[model samples]
Target: MGKPTGFMEYERSVSHAEKPKERIKHFNEFHQPLSMEERKCQGARCMECGVPFCQSGIIIGGMASGCPINNLIPEWNDSIYRGNMKQALSRLMKTNNFPEFTGRVCPAPCEAACTCSLNGDAVAIKENELTIIEHAYEEGYFKPNPPKVRTGKKIAIIGSGPAGLSAADQLNKRGHSVTVYERSDRLGGLLMYGIPNMKLEKQIIKRRINIMKEEGITFVTKADIGGNYNAEEIMKSYDSVILACGASNPRDIKVPGREAKGIHFAVDYLKATTKDILDRNKTLTPDFKNFTITAKGKKVLVIGGGDTGNDCVGTAIRQGAISVVQLEMMPKLPDQRADNNPWPEWPKVAKTDYGQEEAISLYGEDPRVYQTTVREFIADEQGNVCKAKIVRLESKFNEESKRFMMEEIAGSEYEIEVDMVLIAAGFLGAQSYVADAFGVELDVRTNVKTDAGNYQTNVDNVFVAGDMHRGQSLVVWAIREGREAAKAVDTHIMGYSNL
Candidate 1:
C-alpha cells in the first residue's frame, strides 16, 4: 500500500449533487464530481485489507457482495495514490470495459463489501473509478487502437446494451471481426433508452460507440434481427451469434382498467422520453407529437418501488406531472442493516435516491406508499384512466403454502384520482418474439435456457448472455456476462479463447 495509515487519516468523500428542487426542473445528470486532488485522497482511503472483499464478487445471503467483474481495487487505488493516473486507467480497463457506465449507475456492491464499511463509511471506490476514467479521456490516454491483426472469424451480437458492447469489445481485442445489431434508431439498447438521461447522459454512450467504430466494429442501427431482418440468414452469415438482447418484457399489473388509454409500460414511457430528448437536441424543433405516453399535466401513479419506478417519478416530474405516487407491495426495508444481515453481505436497508429526494422536496413528503398495491383502475367514459383503487397489504408466512403471502387488510381499500398509470414492477425475462424466432428454448422463468456452465444454447452456435440469460440484473453483471460469453463464442469458433 502506498500509505499504510491513509485510511485512518482520510474520511470518505463523494460527488456533490444539485439540490433536488433545482435539479428536478431538468432531465440532466445532477452529480458534480470532485476534483483530482480530493479524489486521490479518496483513493488513499482504501485500507488494502488482507482479503480485500471489495473485489471478491461473492454471493452472500443470495445477493452479490462486490464487483461482479472482480476489479483490482487495491492496485488501482495504490496507483492513484502514487499519482500514476495512466497506470490506474490501465489497471481499471483490465477488468471492466465500461467504467463510465457502471461508475454512474451501479449500486456499488463493492462498497457494501468493503472492509472499511464494517464500521464507518466505505471508501469512495465508484467515484474514484469515475475520476480515473474521465481523467484518462481528458488527457488523451484513450485512443482508437484497432487490432494489429485479424483472426478472420466474424461474430454477430443481437443487442447493443452493456453486455453486447462488452462482448464486442473483448472479441474485437482478440482480433475477431464483430458486428453489433441494434433495433433502435440509435445504438445502446438499454443504456440509451431504458435508463433515464438524468442517471447517464447519452453523450457518454455515443463517445464510446464512436471509439468502437474507429476500432473497426460495425454498428447496424434500426436492424431488428427477428422481426424486420432475417434472423436465420444472419446466423448463417456469422461464424457465431451472441444474443445479448436484454430482458425487456415488463411485468404488467392486471387490474380492472388495464386497457385504459393512459396506461403504459415503464419501458415504453422511458424510451419515448429519451427519444424525444435526443430528437429535439438533434433538430432545433422541440416536437413531441410522436410520443403517445406522456405525463404532462397528469396525476401520475407508478406501480412498483424499484429503481425503474424512481426513474419514472423523476421523468414525470420533468414532464410536468401534477402529482406522483409510487406503490410497493412489500414492506419498506430498514434504514440500517438488521442483525441478521451481517458484514460483507448486501445491506438490507433503505436508500433515498435522487428521484425520491426530489419528490419529497416538491410534494413535502415521500412519494412511496409502502405495503400498498393497486387493486383496480377507474376510467371515465372515454376509456381514459381517472383513478386507482388501492388497498393496504399485510405480509404473513402461510404454513400450508410454506412461503410468504400478501393478504389484503380488511376495510383498507381506497381510491385516488390519477390521470396516468405506469407499470414499473420490474421485468420477467426476455421478450418471447426474439427467442421464438431463433427457435431457442427458454427456462421456466422465460429467460433463455443454457447449460449451467456454458453460454451456448441447446442449438449449436447460438449463445445468450446478460439479462436475456440471467434475468433482469445490474449493469455490472451484464458486462461480466458479455465478457464471459465473448470468450465462449471465441473458443467455439477458434480452437480456444485468448480474450
Candidate 2:
C-alpha cells in the first residue's frame, strides 16, 4: 500500500480521449495520456484490499470477473504510485507477455472487480499498465533478452494472432525453438487486419514483431498451415505443434437476399478498409470512389450490437457514410447494474463505444436499434443491397424449453434505405479446414477438443488454444490460453515443465 488512505485521498482518473468528430478524421489511437503526476494520483487510488478481486481472474455469474491472466494489479499500481515504472513493467511482464496490446485493446475486467468500484471509481489499472509499458519502451528498457540456453526442442505454432504469438513467446523463452506461421499476407492475424487502425495502429504490431524477431523467435507470414501449405509436413518437422488459429469463421444472418453484392462480413470489410489505409498511407478521401463494397456516400446498416458492430459504425463514418444504423436482436441493458447483478461481477450495462459516440455526434442519435433484426435485404437490379426489411423482436420464456427466446412481433415490421450492409454477428468456431487437416477432434461447440483443464488434443503431440480451443473470446483470454498451452507443450516435451 503506497498510501493507506490512498483510495479515499485520491480520486480515479484515466486518459482523455479525443472528441468523437475530430478523432473520426483519422484512424489512429485518440486517447491523450495524463501527465505523470495525474497518472500517479490515479495509481494511488488502489485500495489494495485484503481480498483483491481485481487480480482474482475468476468467473462470476458466467463472466470473467477480473484480469484473466491474473495480473499483479496491486503490486504494479503501488509501483506506479511510487514512480518506479521499471518495477511496474517488470511486475506486468511477469504475467502478461503483451501488456501493450492488452493495455490498448482489453476491456479491463480488473477495474470492474476492483473493491473501490463498489462505491466509487476503480483504480486506473489498465491506464497505469499502459503508462508503465509505454514508458519502458521510450526508455529502451523494453528490449529483447533471448534465452541463455537452448532446450533443443522445436515447436510450430499456426496462426500469428495474439494466442499464437504469446505461445511462441513463452515457448521460446523456455529455450524451445519456436516458429509461427500466419495465413494472412501480414502478421498479427486479427490484430493486423480484422481491427481498424484507429483502435490499434499497424505500426504498434510491427514494433513488437521486431522485438520478438530479435529474441530468436522465428515468424513466417503468408504461410497458411492448412490451406496451400502442407499441414502433415509441419507435424513431421516440429517435435510438437500448437494450433493457436483463432475462431476464424464469421457467423452469418441467414435471412432473405443474403447474397447481395453490397453486403459483406464485418471482418472482411474491416480488413479491406484497414489494408487500404495502410497501402494508400492515408484515410480515404470523402469524395473518393466507392469502387468496391465500401461505405462512402452510402447509408450503412450494421447487423449486430457488439464491439465489432460498433467498429463498423466508426469505420463507416470515417469512410464518409451518409448515415449508419446498427441492429441488435437482444434487449438493451440497464443504465446501471440491476438487482441480480452486484459488485465483483461483470456488469452487464449499456456502453456507447467510440463508433457509437461518433455516430451520435454526427447523426444526432445512437446508431443502435435494440430488439430489432433485419428480416431481409432488398437488392437492386444490379444485385446490390438497396434497402433492408427489419422487424422488432420480443423475448418470451418457454416453460418447457427453459430458456428465453426471441420472437418477431407481428405488426412491428419496417423497411429502411441502406446501401451497404455489414454483418458483425461474431464468430462461429475455428474454421473446420485447419482441424480437418490436423485430424483433431472438435467438441460440441466445434472448438478443438481437449480434456478438461488441458490444452493437448486427442492426437498426441498436437495441442490447441485461444479461440480455436475455447471458442470466440477476448484478446486477454487468448493470451492466457496461449500461455497455458505453452506450458502443456513444454511438459509433454520434457516430461516436466518449468515454464
TM-score of each: 0.98, 0.98
Name the lDDT of candidate 2.
0.91
What is candidate 1's lDDT per residue for 181-262, written digit by digit as tens?
9998999989999999999999999999999999999999999888899989998999999999999889989878788889
Model 2 vs. true fold: TM: 0.98
lDDT of 2 by residue, 86-172 (tens): 999989999999988999899999999999999988888888998998899899999999999998999999989999999999999
RMSD of each: 1.7, 1.2
Candidate 1: misplaced stretches above 4 Å?
Answer: 282-292
Q: Give the clash total for candidate 2.
A: 0
What is the Å distance of residue 220 in model 1 from its true position? 0.5
